[model samples]
Target: MRKPNAARDQLLHDLRNAYEGGASIRTLVASTGRSYGSIHSMLIESGTPLRGRGGPNHRRRVP
Candidate 1:
């Protein structure tokens, strides 16, 4: 059996909960002191079902 990674698992859990609680990746990065890419990758690895990108609909505006 492999050694358990409690800390990493907890981080993944916390990230997942925070994400499901509507916390943005940027916000999570700031709060967790983790890099944007690292946090984003973690969120994906943790299966957070990332929300769509933020900002106004440029396609709608250009139409």
Candidate 2:
């Protein structure tokens, strides 16, 4: 459980870390009980480069 009223920086750090670690915003929303818009906004606010749709390896590369 997180402390109520956690600092913005701290929350952003956690959100960014989770996102970078391959956890999607939807996953975070489920875990954090926050809305999709809230999660998306925070990721943007934290300057975390958002991933494209369909997640990892959506398309295969020719070798």
Candidate 3:
């Protein structure tokens, strides 16, 4: 699969920074209008230490 776009990565970075700076999930959703699940996944993939089974735990990629 193709890599994620640079703009998207930048947005992800910005969102993470905002989240780290005490912005609530609700506030993030309101400000960016992004779904909670999408934001959560981005945060996880961006390597931000997250709660619960944050990483891809055990599933293997198919060749």
Error of 1 at 19 (Å): 0.8
TM-scores across all candidates? 0.80, 0.76, 0.68
User: Per-residue lDDT of 1-63 in model 3, one digit per residue for the tens?
Assistant: 758799988988997898778776667888888898888888887777654433478888899
The best-first sequence of candidates by lDDT reads 2, 1, 3
**Runs in model 1 with CA error above 4 Å?**
1-3, 58-63
Query: lDDT by residue for model 2 over 1-54, one digit each (tens)?
Result: 645565877999999999999999999999999999999999998899999887
Model 1 C-alpha lDDT per residue in residues 1-63, reported as the tens digit of each score: 647699998999999999999999899989999899999998898888988897865655544
Score residue 3 of candidate 1 by CA lDDT: 71
User: Best-fitting candidate, measured by lDDT?
Assistant: 2
Sorted on TM-score, best first, the list reads: 1, 2, 3
Q: Relative to the unseen true structure, what is the Cα RMSD of model 2?
A: 5.8
User: Per-residue lDDT for 11 in model 1?
Assistant: 94
lDDT for model 3: 0.78
- Which is the winner by lDDT between candidate 1 and candidate 3? 1
RMSD for each model, in Å, please? 2.8, 5.8, 11.4
